[model samples]
Target: MVKRLTKHGNSLALVIDRGVLDLLEIDADTPLSMTTDGKCLIVTPVRDPERQKQFRAALEEGHRKYGKMLKRLAD
Candidate 1:
């Protein structure tokens, strides 16, 4: 599907269609990454909130289990 960019304040925005939104399982607040691959613009959905929370919890657990060793190394 093609979309037109419209002026939004000082920036341009594209309105995504509902079908595409449903297929991507994304809402208006969903984070997106925009990059240029030489000639084309690449847009992708960023990490979901649940996955981010799980990763953070895992990192905290790892730190709790190995914090003393890390501190010793730092010293």
Candidate 2:
């Protein structure tokens, strides 16, 4: 989708669509990291490290608890 930057005070702002924001799980409170690969702009959420560690631990626990059942289901 094509978008034009809108005036925000003296700076410009890109108005992201609600659907896009929801799909990306981004909100007003989400901290974002912005960079440019020379030509294109890259925007990504800066994930919380502690939250990531918790998620990884939970995922590993789930796999350990359900690996056998999951393999059977896959077959």
Candidate 3:
């Protein structure tokens, strides 16, 4: 979708749509990390370190639980 930057104080801002927000599992109060790759702008939610660790642990646990079934399917 095309978006135009609107003036806000001395800076410009692009409004994010609610659908996009829901897809990203973020809301207005979510902290975001914004960056550019020189070609495109990327915005993502910033995960707290503790939460990141917990998420990683959960992922590892899932991998262990499903590794055999996933490998069988991949074969």
1-75, model 2: which lDDT tens digit per residue?
999999999999999999999999999999999999999999999999999999999999999999999999999
**lDDT score at residue 61, model 3, on the 0-100 scale:** 100
lDDT (tens digit, per residue) of candidate 3 on 2-74: 9999999999999999999999899989999999999999999997899999999999999999989999999
Single out the weakest 10-residue window by summed lDDT for candidate 3.
40-49
Task: Kindly list the per-residue Cα lDDT of model 1 for residues 1-75, writing each as its tens digit.
Answer: 777899999999888889999999988898999999799888889977899999999999999999999999999
| Runs of candidate 1 exceeding 4 Å displacement | 49-75
Candidate 1 global TM-score = 0.59
TM-score computed on alpha carbons, candidate 3: 0.67
Give the local distance difference test score of model 3.
Answer: 0.94
| Residue 57 in model 3: lDDT | 99
Look at candidate 2 and tell me the lDDT of residue 30.
97
Clashes of each: 0, 0, 0
Candidate 2 — what's its lDDT?
0.97
